[model samples]
Target: MASPNMQIARNARTRVADRVTSKVTDALKSDTAFESGSLALSARIAGAAAEAVLELPAEARRTLTRRQAELVRGVRRLVETFGDERGRRKIELIVPETVERSVGEGLGPIVPEEEGKHLLNELAVARKIEDWAGTVAGASELNRDYGIPRSTLHRWQHANEVIGLLKGTKKHVFPVEQFIDGRPALGISAVIGLAGSHRTAWLWLRQANPVLGGRRPIDLLKQDRIEEVIETAQAYFDPQ
Candidate 1:
């Protein structure tokens, strides 16, 4: 019961949606992490495009150039969301600054083709050093190496007062730097709690601080500059 012109316009919109879906899918399929859920997201995008075109006036929807532009904008939005989640996790390892940059740019993918490859290579190297900088130990290792009892460890974890990251099967892995001379370092619990979780604390602890004369917090802690480290952590927790 629709007129021929209306049916033709509807068919054109369907073709635009299909084209956009194909382009978006092709762009994302290269990333293994993206491929899993992308098909479903792409379908949703196509449906959204169809609905959006309907909301436009009939003449606007019939304009091929306008329709193409709309499809491209929808596809870009899809890519941005995918990029943001992937960037948040991987960029933390390669370059922490990239996370802020990505978000500031509206969660868009910030890396160009050549730059992205370079980042991927750096990420591969970073993974190798993860044992020292990013690794965490299980409860048994903590007990053996640092004499931390499972009950006390779990207590801190439950209280959200330690640097244990949950791993496979709900097992918690504590960062090695949390220990010193068979005990948890003084003020570490408070610092961990204050900095708002282990990941943020890890970033603060590992990076050089201008206030500490460019020395790393972990190095100061290793030197038993406990009070200074705590002050630095507090500064980092609530900076000027």
Candidate 2:
């Protein structure tokens, strides 16, 4: 039999768990996109799923075991988050560099064949995005070429004032075009916010937009044509 003190502790833990559950539910319920059936909705659901799975109960374990398909979809939703138009990046690289031999070589022993294949494909897509980010340079190169301090650069990356692409295991590569006059261009942050994620924003900035009269947004940013670039980005990402 459990002692009175032990029972009290258990009740306290249960109450805490209940409160956490309520918060997660309320957050999603109050969201405007809860019923939108958009990626926004999917993202919120994935986050809520993660929080629910964190609960200390047999139901949480059962969720992992019984609702495996939902969990897989949640994984995809989480992956898609790396490209949020709000300019969030330096996301962890969970997949290997190459998909070749990734399956039967090692993963087959663990992940199911179908699941392994899907994981590798996602990895390849991520690598392609990294390539689109252009030839990246480390902090030393950026500082030497741009004359900026490592501390300041790190702060900019943290604040999304500068685009920082996570390339390898734990290193980040910055796009050279993002800088002008030894600082990030005036509209880089805005473009990122309007465009969504670092990968998409960088890709769009590098491409010549017809709306910008065939001028790349990055070039316009360098030239301080911020209004044109922001307008273009807004239309491109949130076209009515």
Best by lDDT: 2
The prediction achieving the highest TM-score against the true structure is 2
Q: lDDT per residue, candidate 1, 36-58, as tens digits? A: 57675866676567667666777
Write out the backbone clash pairs for model 1.
Answer: none
Determine which window of 10 residues in candidate 1 has minimal summed lDDT: 64-73
Steric collisions counted per model = 0, 4
Listed in order, each prediction's TM-score against the native is: 0.42, 0.48
Give the poorly placed runs of model 1, Cα more than 4 Å off: 1-135, 159-161
TM accuracy, model 1: 0.42
